[model samples]
Target: MTLRVYLFVFKSRGYIHIVNIFNQMSSDGVTKYKYEYIIVGAGTAGQTIAAGLPSKDVLILEAGGYTTSLLDIPILTPILQKSDFDWSYETVPQPNSCLGLRQQRSRWPMGKGYGGSQILNNMIWNVGHHEDYRGWFSPEEDYNYERDILPYFRESEAEHQPTILKHRTKLAEAFMNATKEYGYDDSFKVPHLTQRNGKRWNMAHENHENNLSHHLVLNAFVMHLLFDRTSINRVTGLVYEKNGFEFEILATKGVILSAGAIGTPLILLSSGIGPKKELINTTVTFRKDLPVGHNLQDHVTTGLDLILLNDTLGMRPWEVFTLNSFYQYFVNGDGPLTMNGCEVVGFLNSTNKSKNWDLGFMVLPIGASADAGIHFKQILNIKDNTWSQYFDPLTSQQSVSILPILLHPKSRGQITLKDDVILIDPKYLTHEDDVDLIVTGIRIIEQLIEMPSMRRLGAELNPKPFPGCENYEFASNAYWKCYVRHLTLTAFHPVGTCKMGSSDDQSSVVNREFQVIGIENLFVVDASVMPNLPSGNPNAAVAMLAKKFLSVLLQSHREKPTNYDI
Candidate 1:
């Protein structure tokens, strides 16, 4: 017998569609239908929330399509980034960095499909310092935020304790073992392999299974939030389009905008919930005008590329495409299938006198200058000739890249509307202090590379020919600074667009509870609400926030008395 389950209808770009699924039961006569939850975007944070939520209905509205090929996994991220799955966003050319660099495209790899950017990202998991979050609220507070959040981090991780390698020929295993032994494991926990029995564990699939009460509709793009000003001034529902038709989804309880930093603010500004002056000046109907798209923040990453004496540490072409590898993945669910491009990470302050590590770095065993944009385009089949523009033989190479990331940038940018369309000016490196932090970070990495442990592995300095240095002065602080400005890019951890704080804080867009000040039943739960960028990767923090919000929701539900008499 065949069973049909009806899910909600949603809009995408400019289309509308009603989604449903049909299931065929087995001979045992036991069958279960998935729940539905309307989740927008299947990126890192989105997928984490979907996977962790309790069993209920889930409906994910993704503007992108689905992934069916192994090429979509993290191992092939360098190649997959050039495809259509990536938004391929380019920043307005700045006078500071990428001076000689072409077009200044930021290479915003927001995956357009089920797995979101997780499918195309470097996949390095680094949770920021505990003090980073608590510091934002109050510098005097001694609360153990790390202890509170560590459990949430552990909940998401699937640890692997393998024996240390001794004179191993396998590059992947050696890299993992070396990182574990070199004090890297004690700094922060690595993310559990997102593969289920060898296959990529697309969070959309897991979230759907856990949350059966809600429905996830792929290829659905939300355009605006429908608000009811006549009653309670609360958000009523969302209006979206899919398949060239428009439809409205009415929310009974509340409207939670879990869209990432970029998409969340874009949707709000489009719905007339931004700065009042801007909305009144535009064609949009004004609502709150509460600075919805202000204070944009992102981590700026600069790298030092070092050529290794041995090529044994990187992936071979045969490893990428071989019958033996595929058989191992499909049958035993092992081999290179479990690898997530980035395997080692470190977080430390550029200056030891600082409160905590402001500088963060991740180790990638492959070439540093691979075309991140072109890599995504090929995977999603987005036709474009721009791939050749950024490809340069001299700059790109097959060597391990050590990236130094500035966690707390004093420089802040903004997102505004141009004829009601999203326009972002990341405004990277605007402040001298921000630039100094990044410059100091590069010097730190240089020291790390020259350490006894790393040098023993035969690490070589990058930019074989320094622009302003003599042959012997390759690794000077000044030379590193020049290279950093030209090569540094966003870490893709944009936040603070809709900051959270007390009502008195002018910079705050939402309260500590994540509720928008002027509106009821409306909350911002993604990275956009971060008052400041964390010291490391923001994905784990985003997941922890989701769990924290759910806990508050459950506690509130239990406290309220239910009335049975009608």
Candidate 2:
């Protein structure tokens, strides 16, 4: 394919960012070549596509650097959140919940490097139940959980032991027993994650050591897609900033935006692909009048922590911090560090709600003591002592957390432009129905704690409500409402900002095929294209989209035989 490239060198802030063409050769000072495919954002979703394509013809651009050894162990997931491995996104002040947090902002930890959230997530792998995808406008379109998504899930999963849950604490056992008694399901299973032999296996592993993709560019930030802006608005390539320099690369076939939900809309808006009124203030020229950043949704959550009345119930906090604990994991992958913090989860319908509004219960082995809560507060970006209500005094006692994830929130939020920076407002629990569900979920957790099995383990609610909700009678529905309003946190599963629908859908940015409407040779393959957030974590769902995107895009590019008629 004929190609054109222009390298622009510049400096931003105090660092240098250089942009380079994938086909640029070291032997020649100047080289010009067009890539067959350009995949923006080298996260988990992008790697799924890159791994299947011919290595030399594809080029992937990632914003973060390489993966570090710290990510190899599942337990170190939290430590990587604020480190350079993370994108370090902080939300604007939420007027609704987290009232006692320092600035009322929630810290969103997105992985900046290769694996994306795979590098920072709890690593519990699930594509969600088939029912979660049953009610879509067209079940065959993208919501085929059993027929489509689950196949890809099985392909990528490795089932080896030295299993993730090596040390099943008393706390986890109690939660599982509660699920059993409550009859949420007949059997309880530990979390399924992308791991092998007790170590974290991320998406980058698909492309790095394999010859599936030729060019992998890290520390590369995509600015926007380049389009002709003619009648059809055909996309040609993209402009990116690498190191301290800016450059543009041409695509022969197409460019796919696999940037996560937040990153996808930012690039779209910056490229003038969103509602024109929002882009009027930006310098980038308008390209498409699609509702790019609308319909943003996420899984919102709140939790109940119980300081075990049984001192001998689990390992003590001091025992958890000692050197022997470290030895247990490092020397033998068989201790606290052997597992992801969330080893078990339960799915249930909230009281008086349909199965559509499901609730997820995840067990946290660490309690809210100063030592344990520090990790959570830093990750949640909670500044004040509001979370202190959940903590027990730093004594011999150990605690565990049972939090509920709000599935299918009717509440709608958005990712928009605040000046040039992306603005996120999840608008958690804005709907009365959503609040009802969360309150119901909290009640469910309470019931589980009171069950014969869980009660035997010393699980009891703190009667004193959080500080902000003290005006209401403690443990009443009103009190729980206030408590939920102040303590709400995201499950970190955001989707549907750039929605996918048929071409006539005024609100959809992309069509059922995942191609950006009103534009040619450009598509979005990440969570942004989800019509609705999946019932569980969206990582597996996003990977399914990548598979479909690759299959369709490549099939269209296949050459016709000379004997065939036009």
lDDT of model 2 at residue 236? Answer: 81
Worst 10 residues of 1 by lDDT: 1-10
> How close is every model to the real structure, measured as TM-score?
0.79, 0.87
Candidate 2, residues 64-136: lDDT per residue as tens digits? 7665454576765666766666777777788877665668777777877777778778777766767665533
TM-score of 1: 0.79
> How do the residues 12-122 of candidate 1 rate in per-residue lDDT, one tens digit apiece?
101211111111111111022222234567765566655554435444566666655454343555444434455665566666764434554455556566667666654
Report the C-alpha displacement of residue 514, candidate 1, in angstroms.
1.5
- Alpha carbon lDDT of each predicted model: 0.59, 0.70
Task: State the displacement of the C-alpha of residue 535, model 2, in Å, after optimal TM-score superposition.
Answer: 1.3
